[model samples]
Target: MARNREKEDVESRFNPPVSISMADSSISLLKLISILIIFVVGVVIGLVSSSHIDRYFTFQGDEFNFKNTYFDTEQFSHDGQKMVVNCDGEDCLSMESFVRLRNLNHRLRDDELFWRASFVPQKEELPFRRVPRVAFMFLTRGPLPMLPLWERFFSGQDVEKYSIYVHALPGFDLEVSNSSVFYRRQIPIAACRMGSVSLVDAEKRLLANALLDFSNERFVLLSESCIPVHDFPTVYKYLIESIHSFVDSYDDPTRYGRGRYSRRMKPDIKLADWRKGSQWFEMHRALAVKIVADTKYYTLFKKYCKPSCYPDEHYIPTYIRKFHGALNANRSITYVDWSQMGPHPATFTAGNITEGFLESLRNNGTRCSYNSGKTSICYLFARKFDPSALEPLLNITAQVMGF
Candidate 1:
């Protein structure tokens, strides 16, 4: 019996008997309370963790396209609206009622849909119609302050097809008139401070918003100070009828040319690797989507890109180089004198703008044509013009610039 008792004691010490008996209520109740406390604590912890996780991925007010095009979730409240704008098919009744449509991920599988796209296109290839209208997007700080000169250039019989979008600084109450050429047409705008990446942001906002309502096919980003070197029809024919568009990555082995991609855009899509030229570029609607929807590279740009390095000059060209370099003719259409460096291009003075200079500008160099219709790579516009230089440009527009 003693031997049996000793073995029982050893077993009990090694593996204590669970006192989960109703008769032993005190210990059992204590254990039940402890278990309940533990469960409650776990529940609280789980709830907090769940909330934190949900908030992590919650969508902010800022939107992204389903397929990186202009189709935003919030732009249209109702369904069945037609796509009034596109690169291919002429402005006609769209089969899909834009309001009823919800798919943000629509991508074309056909080629030739974008005339010259590197990626997916629509199945039903649309033919090139009578020269497509080009939208000249003038990104400015507003008032135009020089609208009268631009008015003379834009107000002609052949200018009916083309449209203009003005992106101005947010605060200024733009001096607009009912009789002014800019009546009733203010583009969706974001604010910008000079010599900042916010300029790129403003440009993107302008493009994306215009993509919603405008029918103009080709997009040219012009500044408030820009002036037409040629007429609207000539510029239109130059781009549409040309074999390729002018979008380039100005790579200089001796120096960095692309200013859009900042030093911060590295490891994922570095400035050096994804380099592009200047802020002034002519882009197709298709390329615009790739730019705004570029999370892979753009996110990196947002993190590392800063004010000092001038990412605006480099990002666009670098991205185009990586994704759509081939679509471009690899040259910029807007004329700029880059020989003088720093914050901006050389501002043209009135004395500098002469009839001879106008001729030189109108026939400065040959442009590459994708249209197969026009001969020269027509420089649609030139920029960094001083307000005073406006007089000379206007004086010679009839002779040199078709407008």
Candidate 2:
């Protein structure tokens, strides 16, 4: 009897009751479920908070701020309706509609589509008399040392005939009097490095902004070093009356021209289609709009035209030749002296600003076709002028250039 009791106690110590084991198992499973539930709830709360934060920062009072960088939006009451004006100027469209039209992203593909779709064809004649205005687009790094000279060129001219636009480095503001023509003409721009695609981007950005105004019929691209070789009237008449765009485009078999052509450009751009020319060009409104709306060839150049390729020098020339050959005069209206054998053209300084030199630029003995006939009045603007030449240029403007 004693041995039987001892064996039974040993067995009881080795194994516990099944009810107690089941109860512990149930408690452990409950704890695990509670932990999982807490985790899921926390994740849901985090996602909701993140969404709200994104919304709060993205919009404010009917204004779409692009990280507070691109455009400055102002809200005001106009005739009992809320209106938002962009940094460019007063826009009568509702803020929602304006945002929809001006919604540009960093993606070039989407932006090109938007611009192409926004283009309105002039199929019908307008009821009101439309006065065509020339858009003078200046691409500069920072301040315009030649602003005084340009101010003189535009002085006393009818405001209805011309519009001024400046594309400077981002965050740069030109300090000028309120009455100055370029007082509020700076457009939103990105940083541009010499000989890079960013330079091409800046050019396109300037064109896009000028296209916003319906009155702009002609677009002229100028640099900070560029000075008007002729007065406003002469230059205006030359550009506005021209039937073809003045773009320097030519076929060269040299290493610098066709040699820069890449095989990757393939079916889109061929070796025979390659061209080289000056970056400074004067284009009509139709060409300007085409350039802004182009994505097919622009993408090709942006991808294949790397360093040494120089997109600014080649892309526009090649594109114009390929697509709009007949519309282009195949010559640049901006004079640049390439006599010096180097990568860059000769830059004119204060001492070089002579009446004879100015005369040479005006009629450089080179005859070209203008309006289906030949004319020697080739260049309307000369570039690569140093800042020191501003004073001399201003002095000779009235007598030689005839402003």
Candidate 3:
């Protein structure tokens, strides 16, 4: 009996109690399930927090996210009337309405920024239905001496078909009759010097202002010295109906052309991409928007194309050729007589404003490629007319120039 009792005690010591083993296994499973539940709950909470943070800012379409860039989401709203952004067919904002909402106190130094901020990338194409008009943008220094001639030209035409925006020097005021076409048409002015980047800025400003009007389909950059050689209807129809824009883009490998290229402009503008042309451009609405919204090429030109380089002459030509070559005819309708000596074109005085001279300007010039065919009557306007020639122009415009 003593031996049997000792054997039973040894067996109890070697084997573990079944109840304690079962309790330990159940406790381990419970611990693992609790850990899993905590992990799942943590993940759910993180997802919900992130979703709420993203919801604080409302993104407009996929293209525009003006939440925190230049404007605040709150600034876009006022007194419960939420600002509605209407994008045109080209995916550009209607600048008229946009400017109204913008904080004028916080204007940026870069005008191009305004245009870039207003750009909205279009996703689905919408049906386009708007009667388009021409925007005759004039870049001038002070008074438009040829206003009388322009008044005669635009006299009988429907005002709805065309719009005029003039950019002049600041603080230079002119007496404009209410009956005149240029009356009350001057836009906000900035000091612009010839052959400077300021000229390009003024040009872009004019374009930006005209873009506010959705009806403007064509943009023609003109000067105070410029006068329409063709009548209002004729010039309007010619510009609006044309399939390609009239921009004089040519490769001048000579001293004045390729020599103007700055090495700093490289990586963005290569030597092969160098171009030169007339500053005056008549572009379709699509190209005009692109010009206003461009920051890349404009910045390059502003830094590189300077005094002798002439940004006004080089910027548009190189930009258009590099990107929108197919949309251009590579010619300018404005006639400039560079045959005379000096940097300036031949300026026509009162003595040179005869009917024959005007007629020659109308149809007697070098042949140019128009609509894929050569034409003799290519010039639609002429430049560098003396202020004194205004009366002579007025005298002969109705009889000879057919204005």
Candidate 4:
């Protein structure tokens, strides 16, 4: 009996109680189950997060696709109800929001993308009445010293008949009073150098911005020095009633003309197709859309047309002549004196602002056809006027220019 009790004690020391062992087993099983549950939840969360990230980042090529999705408006606000969400330093918004919010205040920075996106055709006619307004686009270096004259010209005119757009250098602002016609008229501009494609780019930028307003039926390219030769009524009646766009396109066999043509502009633009014209132009809406939407010819000129080959002087003329020749009047409405025979046109001064000189400009002995009828009123505007001419112009604007 003593030996048996000793063996049992040894066995008890070696092994624990059955009840305690069963309790430990239960705890171990519980721990395993908890660990498995935690791992499964972690995997599920990771998968969902990855899917959301992919959807947010990827932009599929489809109309009204993920590219148009906007952030929650409650969290982000800009320009009233719309908000421009910045994703990796890019503006992203839905088509609905973009159309509602897009205006002159918003800048279209990317040239290639803007051109491509804006090239879309309006298949359906406008749903509302479009009052045709002339868009006077000014491509200038900086300040408009002649703003007072323009203000006077635009003053008292029906506001619905005209719209003004100024394209000055980037970071340069136009100083005009709240009551002035040029107030808040500046558009987003790019840096432009003389005798470069960038000048053409600036012009196109102006056209694109003006094209934003569906009511703009005519586009006139102007400079800081350009002034109205005729009254506002005469100019408006001439342009608004015209059948053809006034683009100064003519063939010149001289070195300045055909010599500027490059053999590289072959197949697409032949020597016969090449023409020259004034940089200043007044074009109809149809032609304006064509020039803004063009990429094939623009690329050619940007690459081949260089210093001597001024794209500003040749690109529009040649392009219009080749494609839309019938639509153009083949003349510039802005008169410039090239008789001096230099790299630049003659710059008129305050002394040149005389009534006789203005009369000659209005009727320059060039009986050009206006709406298929002969009219002495060939030039509607004149350029290269010195800033000093502003006072004299304002002095005689009422009596001589008739407005």
On TM-score, the candidate that comes out on top is: 4
Ranking by lDDT: 4, 2, 3, 1
- Model 1 regions lying over 4 Å from their true place: 1-131, 158-160, 253-266, 270-272, 341-343, 365-378
lDDT, residue 151, model 3: 82
| Winner of 1 and 3 under lDDT | 3
lDDT of each: 0.63, 0.82, 0.80, 0.84
lDDT of 2 by residue, 1-403 (tens): 9999999999888877899889999999999999999999999999999998888776663355442433433455556466444554333344433322333222444375337434865657754455788989999998898889899999999897888888888788878999998877876667888878888888888788777666778999998898888888888888889999988999879889888899999998998899998888889988988888888998999899997889998999999999899999998888888889897889999999889999998888989789989988988888898889988888887888886
TM-score of 2: 0.73
Model 2 clash pairs are: none
Highest lDDT: give the candidate number: 4
- Which residue pairs overlap in candidate 4's backbone? none
- After TM-score superposition, the amount by which residue 45's alpha carbon in candidate 1 deviates from its true location, in angstroms, is 44
Ranking by TM-score: 4, 2, 3, 1
Query: Candidate 2 at 402: error in angstroms?
Result: 1.7
Question: Candidate 4 at residue 4, lDDT?
Answer: 100
When 2 and 3 are scored with lDDT, the better candidate is 2
lDDT of 3: 0.80
Q: Against the true structure, candidate 4 has what lDDT? A: 0.84
- Per-residue lDDT of 51-136 in model 3, one digit per residue for the tens? 87776543343225533433355555667677544343333455444422222222344464446433543744434545668989
RMSD values, in order shown: 14.4, 10.5, 9.9, 7.9
